[model samples]
Each structure stands twice: as structure tokens, then as C-alpha cells.
Target: MHVPDGFIDAPISAATGVVAAGAIAVSLRGARRELDERTAPLAGLVAAFIFAVQMLNFPVAAGTSGHLLGGALAAILVGPYTGVLCVSVVLLMQGILFADGGLTALGVNITDMAITTTVVAYAVFRGLVKILPRTRRSITAASFTAALLSVPAAALVFTLLYALGGTTDVSLGKVATAMIGVHVLIGIGEAAITALTVGAVIAVRPDLVYGARGLEQRLKLRVNGELVDAQAPLEPATPRTSRRKLWIGGLVASLLLAGFVSFYASSNPDGLEKVAADQGIDQKAKEHASADSPLADYGVRDVDDARLSGGLAGVIGVGVTVVAGSGVFWAVRKRRSTSQAA
Candidate 1:
């Protein structure tokens, strides 16, 4: 959920800001081990992909719709630390450029959507993979289960946050019930998308999928009573410029998704927003600060055609998000390179 301003009190929001800042700082350091030459560029792509897919909201209930949260998908594709950064990047871009989420509540959104979802989903994924058969199917299954649980976990976290710092005197129990119930339906959609996307990537390039890296044994075949791993023929180390091609390809895909495909997304309020409105949790919500921005509400300013305005805004959002995300990841990669050299 976007969590607009005035939903949470100032003191609690400030406290969450500090907690989010610290968590991001820790994730940056941890991500150094996760983002190497191959994964660093992919991390940025994961962010942009998340940004793109989130634009396509699917109907969940009568009035509620759901979209990809991207924590599990990103974690399965990249790594947990990098996944946090990915969702954070999308949230930041939506806040600053699209005015989808509130600036003042940025920390709240990041904590609930980025940090909580990634942490819970990754933990569940690791646990399930440990017990299940080490097959690609098992990995897909684990991804599905982890993604399914992550959405409700995030809803619970928001419930707790609202209990502590809610601006209105709504019943905490009722809020929790409604939030969890609606988000569970949303979680199903999240699970399907995460599994399908992870499955597609694993099919094409399992080497690029962080969660499937050590699980390659599942793809091995038995030869003369001995197991032989079916690893892709190792490529001689190539120039770093090759990675730029991948980055460019990912950015182009994100642009296509947002620029054209997003026009077909359902025009209904998402799960959280619908639930809040139905249950009166949104009664205390305030307007977004950047509501007056040209690209506010995912439309270009003075554009009469709804399709053209939304399409242009979506394309600009993808462009801005990819640039911002790639810059952060490239800096992290460079720092890692420098440290290794030293």
C-alpha cells in the first residue's frame, strides 16, 4: 500500500524513518557480497521490472485490486539485500515522480512494503527450499509459497504500525482483520506472478537467478550410475561492456511494459486502498504533497487523451526509475570493486 500522509502521526513516522534508514544502511553493506559483476546490473533490472509490473493492477475483489509487490520476485531473481533496495527504488520513484506514494510516509511504505516483505519472503523461501526436493519445480513451489505469505505479513506489519501511530481512533482489531483478509486475496496474485516470472527466468537463464544458483544439482542427469551436472558451458570471461547490453535490454523491456502495456491495467483502487475505504480506515488520510506535479497520478500534465497521458507518464517513470536504480547499484558495484582491489 502507498500509505499517504496523515495516516500515521508525526512521532511514529519519524521513528519509522530512522528504522528504515538504519535498515537500508545495513542492506547496502550486505548487498556488497550479493552484487557482483553479473548480479549488479540485474539488480537494477529487478527494480525497473518491479516498477513496471506494479503498474498492472489486477482485480482481486468487487472493488479491490492487487499488483506485484516484487519482494519475492526480486529476491528469487537477485538476492534479499538487493531485493530490499529494488523495492525501495520503485517506491522512491513512485513518490517523487508519479506521486503514487506520499513523500512524508516514504519510510513507512519502505518499511512495510520493502523491508518486511523481503525479509519474510526470503526467510520462508530459504526454509522451504531446505526441506523440499532440490528441483527447479521445488524452487518454483517455494517461491510461490513465500510470495503468498509475504503479502499478509506486510499487512500485519502495517496493522501494528497503525495501532501505534494511527491518526484516527479506529478499532485496531477490525483494521487488522480487514487488512489481512483483503491482502490474502492479493497474496494469491502475488504468488502467481512471482512463480511465473521466476520460472520464466529460470528457464531462460538459471545462471542469473540467485536463488537457483546452488540448486543446480536438481538439473543434473545420471550417467553410468554417476550424476553429471548439466551446467551451461562456461563462457570465457568477457568485457564489462557486455553487461551494458543486458542493462540496456532490461531498461527497454521495462519501458515497453510501462509505456504501452500499462494502459490496459485495471483502473480500480488496489487492495489496501479499497479495504481502507470500505472499512473507514482511510477517513483520516491526507492528500499527497506532490499532487500538483505534472506527472502526478500517473498522467502527463495538459494531456487531453487519457491513454497518451498515462502512457507518457508510465514511460517517464520507468526511465527515471531505471536510471536512479542503476546509478545506486553501479555505485555499490564500484565500491565493491575498489575494496577488492585494495
Candidate 2:
């Protein structure tokens, strides 16, 4: 939810910082098992796409809007550990480059948004897939249910954090009720987005969807009166749409969404911002440290044309996020290869 500075006290914020760091450390190791040559690049693109979709905030209530949180979408498309890294990269870029989320509260945002959402979404997804049919439809259904629950789970986590280190003396019960109540509406949007995106990827390249993998049964044949797995062709036929083409298409979609479509996003405050303002959570909120950055507030400095400035900022954000995310994933993949060789 992009918690801003001064919303949580120094001690609690620092504690969350430690928690975030530890989780990242563990995820880095875990990602090695998840990322290989085929999926590593796709993982980076997933991060960039999440960054783009997050810009298009949809109206949720009278004054509140919501955006794709990306945890369930990423976990379903990639894997849980890499999903955490994907969201973390977006948060890092937004904090340092866009001045959107608070630098001081980075840990709080990661813990609530990145860690909690990914863990909960992936867990729910796994549970549903285990019980449901192992079809693409079932995977999509699980993604929808997982995403729907993840948003409120994140809201509940934020409520707990605020209860412990809230700067204001607001009623805890009221805050929880408002936060959970509104986020449930937001969760519906999240569910739709996650399901549609996952279903699209599964349709095109089910091989690339981590959650859909292992669902395809090998063709069985009767040979010499015995049922046996069909022998794979020595030279596997090329996929109609190559991974390179998929990556290019995804990047183009991200560019379109962020560069132009975001202009139509509801201008109302998001769920977090609306709740904070209504609950007096922002009474002690401090200004973002990067507020003066050229790209602050998702606009280029001195770029008078609102459309052009925002478009440039969005494009730059997508470009930077892709490069950074790819770099991280590539390095992780390299480490995996080196260790295997050893």
C-alpha cells in the first residue's frame, strides 16, 4: 500500500526493515531453484508488467480507488520466491525514482505488500490447485481466489502494524473495520486482474506459467499391448509463438498501459491513502525524501504537458524496472548454473 514516512514510529519501522532484509535474503536463495534459462527473463518481464498495471488505478468506492497488487499474478505466472522479488523491485523503483512510496517506510511497504501478499496468495493457490482439477481453468480459478484473499490479508497486516506503531491515537477497531471493509472491494478488482492475466499467459504459453506447469499430462499410447508414454520427437517442433515474441508483446502491452492508459486512471486516492486520510493516519506523515526528484509524483520535472510528462515518466519507469529486474534474475540464474557445475 505504499506506506509513507512518519506513519509508523522509528522502532517499528526499523524492525520491519530487519524483517524485510531477512526475507529478501532467503528469497534470493530460494529463487535459484525457481529461475532457470527459460523462466528467468520472463520473471523480469512480469515485474515490469506489474509496475505498469499498478499505474492504472480503478475506482473502488465513493472516494477510494484500487490497483493490481501483483503478488498473486506474479506467483501464478512465476513462483512465490521470485514473485516477492518482483514486487520488491517495483517498490524499490517507485520509492527511489518516483517518490511514490516513502523511503523510510520502505520496509513496512515490503512487509505488508510484497512478503505478506506473495506468501498468502501462493499458499492459497497451492491449496486450491491441490484439491481442484489440474486444468488451466482450475489454475485460473485458484489465481482468482488467491488474489481476492491476498488484498484483505495485506490490509489486515497493515492494520496490525499501525496498531503497534501508529503515530496517532485513532480507534484501533474503527481503523481495522474501515481498512478491511474497503479493501474487500479492492480485492475483487485484484482477483479479476490476476485471473485474466494468468489465463492469458496459460493460453499462450502454459509452459511459462509456473502454477500451470505439471498440469499437462504426457500423451499415453498402447505399444505391444502395454500402455506407455509416447516417445517425444527427437527434434521438438518450435512453438508457434516463441518466448522472445511473448516477451516483446508483454513489454509493448506494459508500455501502452503505463504510457497512455494510465492517463484515464481514476484520480481519487487509493485505498491506503483514503483510509489514512479518513482515519487521521497521515496527521504526522512526513514529506517524501525524493519529492524533489525530476520524476517525482510520476511526472517529469519542468515538463508542462501533463500527458507528455506523465507518459515519459511511465515509460522511463517501465524501462528501468525491466532492466533492473532482469539484471537481478540473470545474476541469480548465473549463480544457479555455476553451483550446478561445481
Candidate 3:
């Protein structure tokens, strides 16, 4: 849920801005441990994919809709720190380029959507993995549970933030209940998508899936009445395909999700917007600074056909987000390389 401008007072907003900035700085350092030769490029794709899928708002309740918050998916595919950066990058792109969220409330959105979800989901996922069986099914189940809980956690955090500096005089209890209720429904969709995506990646390349790493335990096989440990799948196969193809495939999927599939997304207010209106939280919401931009609101300027305009905008968004996110990751990777060289 993107926090629009004037939702929280200036002081609290500035505080959250500082918190978000610090978290990003720390995550950058942590991501170095996560990003290497193979996963570095995937990090960028993670951001692009998140941006693309978020455009396709699925129906949640009767009139409300929900989109991919993407923290759990990114954390499961890449790493938690990198996941935070991925979602943060998407939020930044949406705010600056598409005018989807407000610039003033950028920190709030990042804090609520990126930081909260990643932390909570990753913690839950890792804990479940430790307790459950070391199989792909377990990983997928954990991913689903983590994603499910993460949405409500984010909603609760957002409610707390709003209570601290809410612009309107709304009942805190009502806001909390509505936010949690709607987001729970949204969470179900989030879990399914996250589980499916993680399962897909794990099926093809378990090594590339960050959460699946180190889970390559040998299976026992009975040979001549003796228990023998069989070879795990982590080893590179003889006909091992280059990771470049997978990266390219991911990029193509991202493009299709944003450029084409998004056309069919539900055209209704998301859970946050619906609750904000219902609870009067959006009473003081201000217009986004980029509202007058040519490509504002996910539509290309001067494009007559609704489909074409949105498609073009989505394509452009994916391109920009991938480029920007790749630049950040590549720079981080380079810094690591230089340090190791020294």
C-alpha cells in the first residue's frame, strides 16, 4: 500500500525517510554477501519482475483489488536484503516516473512495503525451513506461509505509522481492522503467486534460488540392504545450460507480465485506497508531483488506445527499472570485486 502525500505529518515522514535511507545503506552492504557472478543479474530481474507483476492488480474482494507487494517472492528468489532493495527500487520508479505513489511519502511506502515485508517474511521462511523437511515442497510451503503473513504484518505496520501521524481524525480501531481485513485477502493472492514463482525457479535451478541454497541434502537409497547417500542436485549437470538463458527468459516473462497481461488487470481501487476512503485517511492526500508528466498514471501521453498506452508505459517501466536496478547491483558487485582484488 503506497502511502500518499500528506497522509503522515512532515516530522514523522522525515523520520521514516531517515529510517528508510539507513536501512537501504545497510542492505546494500548485506547484499554484497548475497550477490555474486550468477545471482547479480537476477537481482535486477527481480526488481523488474516485481514492477511488472505489480501492474496487474488482481481482484481481491468484490470491489477491491490487490497487486504483488513482492517482498517474499524476491526474498525467496534472491536474498532478503536484495529483496528489500528490489521492492524499494520499484516503489521509487513508480513514484518518480509513473506518479503511482507520492514523492513525499516515499519513505513511508518503502518502510511499510519493502522493509516490513522482507524482514517478517524472511524470518518466517527461514524458521519454517529449519523445522520442516529439507525438500522443495517444504520450501514452497514456507514461501507461501511467509508471504501470507507478510501482508498482514505490513498492513499492521502501516496502521501503526498512520496512528502516529495521521492527517485525518479517523478511528484507529476501524482503520486497523479494515486495513488488516482487506490485506489478509490480498495476502492469499500474494502467497499463491510467491509460492508458484518460487516453485518454478526451484524446479529448474535450485542452485539459483537463494532460499533453496544449502538445502541440497543427500537422499538415502537402499543399496544391498545398506543405506547410501545419493547425490544431490546442486552439482552442475553435464549439459548445464548457461545462466544467461535463464536471465533472458526472466526478462521476457517480466515484459509479458507488464506489457500484455497487465491489460486485463482489474480496474478498481486497491485495498489501501479503498480503506483510506472508507476510513477518511485519504482526506488530506495531495496530488503527486509527477501527475502532470506525460507518462503519468501508467499511460503513455497522447496514446488514444487504452491498451496501447498502458502497454507502452509498462514496457518503459520494466526497461527503466531493470536498467536502474542492474546498475545498482552491478556497481555493488564491482565494489566487491575491487575489495577482493585489494
Candidate 4:
């Protein structure tokens, strides 16, 4: 959920801000180990894909909808630290450009949506992967389970945060129940989306998926009296054209989803919004600081046509997010190279 301004007290907001900043600082360093020639570019695509998917909120309940949080999906596709950065980038873009989330509560959104989801999802994913068979199917199954649990974990974190600094008088128990209940259904959708995305990537390029690393154990060959790891058969190197095709295909899919398909997404309020309206948690919610921006609320200001405005904004968002995310990852990759050289 994207917490709005004034929903949380100033003290709690500032505290969460500090926490978010620290998490980002640490992730920046950790991501260095995760980003390589194959993964760095994919990381940016993952972020952009998340942004695009989040725009298409599917109906989860009668009057509530849910979107892909992208934590489990990103962590499964890329790496956990990079997943955190990926979701954080999306939140930042939403807040500043689209006015979807509150500027003052940016830290809360990051803490709940970015840090909490990624940590919990990755932990669950790794645990399940270790216990389950080391097959591609097992990876997909783990992705589904990890994503299924992550949504409720985020809701619980929000409830705890609200209890600490809620600006409204509401029953904490009711809020918790409602939040958890709706998000559980949302979690199903999350699981399906995460599983399908991870499965597709694993099918095409399992090596590109960080969670799928070491999945294929090397065969052993008997040498003399001892068995030793056999050298893998040398295969033709993957062509640069093939890599370019994958990247281009992903970008085109993202554009189509955000620019065209999003127009038909459900109009119902999401889980958090429905709960807030029901539980009075949004009584003191304030307008976003960027509400007056040209691209606020996922539409271009002064654009009368809804479809055109929204489509244009969505396209622009994908473009900007991809550029920004790619820049960050490329810089991290470069820093890693410099350190290795030193």
C-alpha cells in the first residue's frame, strides 16, 4: 500500500525515512555482487516491467483490486538486494512523477513495499528452494509460495506502523483483520503473476535467473579410481543478436501493457484504499505534494482525452523508470569493476 501524507505522524515518518535511507545504502553495496554483464541490464527491465504491471490492477475481491508488488518476482528474476532497489525505484517514480504515493510518506512506502516485501519474499524463496527439489518446477513453486506470503507480511508491517503513529482513531484489530484478509486474496494474484513471470524467464534463460543459479548440478565422471566433476560440453556461444532480441521483446511488452492494456484495468479501489475508507485510517490523509504536476495521478495534465493522456503518461513513466534504473545498475556494475581492478 502507498501510504498517504498525514496518515502517519511526523515522528514515525522521519524514523521510517531514516530506516529506508539506511536500507538503500546497504542495498547499493550488496547489489554490486549481484549485477554482472548478464544481470545488470535485466535488472532495469525488471523494474520497468514492475512499473508496467502495477498499473494494471486486477480485481481481487468484489470491490477491491490488487497489483503486482514485484518483490518476489524481482528477487526471483534478479537478486534480493537488486529487487529492493528495483521496487524502490518504482515507488520513487510513482511518488514524484505520477503522484500515486505521498511524498512525505515516501519512507513508509519504501519500508513497507520495498524493504519488507523483498526481505520476506527472498527469505521464503530461498528456504523453499533449499527444501524443495532443485528443479525448474521447484523454483516456480517456490516463487509462487514466496510471493503468496509476502503481501500479508507487508500488510502486517503497515498495521504495526499505523499502530505506532496513526493519525486517526480506528480499531487496530479491525484494521489488522481487514488489511490481512484482503491482502491474502491479493497474495494469490501476486503468486500467480510471480510464478508465471519467473517460469517464463527460467524456461528461456535459467542462467539469467539469480535464484536458479546452481540448479543444474554438474555431472560426475569417473577418472582413474575417483569420480570428478565433468566438464560441461562446449556449446555455441549465445549470439549478441539473441540477447538484444530478448531485451527488445521485454521493452515492447512493457509498452503494450502500460500504454494500452492498462486502460481496461479494474476501476475498483485497491486493498489499502478500501480498508482505509472502511476503517477510517485515512481520516487525516493529505494531498500528495506533487498533485499539481503535469503527470500527476497517472495522467497528463490539461489532456482531455483519458485514453491518450493515460497512455502517454504510462509510456513516459516506463521510459523514465527504465533509464533511471539502468543508470543506477550500470553505475553499480562499473563501481564493482573498479574495485576488482584496484
Report lDDT per candidate.
Answer: 0.86, 0.92, 0.92, 0.91
Lowest-sum lDDT 10-residue window in model 3:
233-242
lDDT of 3 by residue, 1-342 (tens): 888898898988988999999999999998988999889999999999999999989999988999989999999889999999999999999999999878989999999999999999999999999999778999999999999999999999999999898999999999999999999999999999999999887777778899988876568999999999886764345424457887899899999989999999999999999999888899999999999888899999999999999999999999999999999999988988988899
Q: Please identify model 4 stretches exceeding 4 Å from their true place.
A: 217-241
Q: What are the per-residue Cα lDDT tens digits for candidate 4 across 154-270?
A: 999999999999999899999999999999999999999999998877767677889987665457888898999864422223533355677788898999999999999998999
| Model 1 lDDT-worst window of ten | 232-241
Q: Tens-digit lDDT track for model 2 on 116-231?
A: 99999999999998888557788899999999999999999999999999999999998899999999999999999999999888777777888876664346799899999864
Clashes of each: 0, 0, 0, 0
Better of 1 and 2 by TM-score: 2
Q: The CA-based lDDT of model 4 is what?
A: 0.91
Candidate 1: the clashing residue pairs are none
RMSD of 2: 2.7
TM-score between candidate 1 and the true structure: 0.92
Cα-based lDDT at residue 7, candidate 3: 89
Cα displacement (Å) at residue 37, model 2: 0.5
Off by over 4 Å in 1: 218-249
lDDT of 1: 0.86
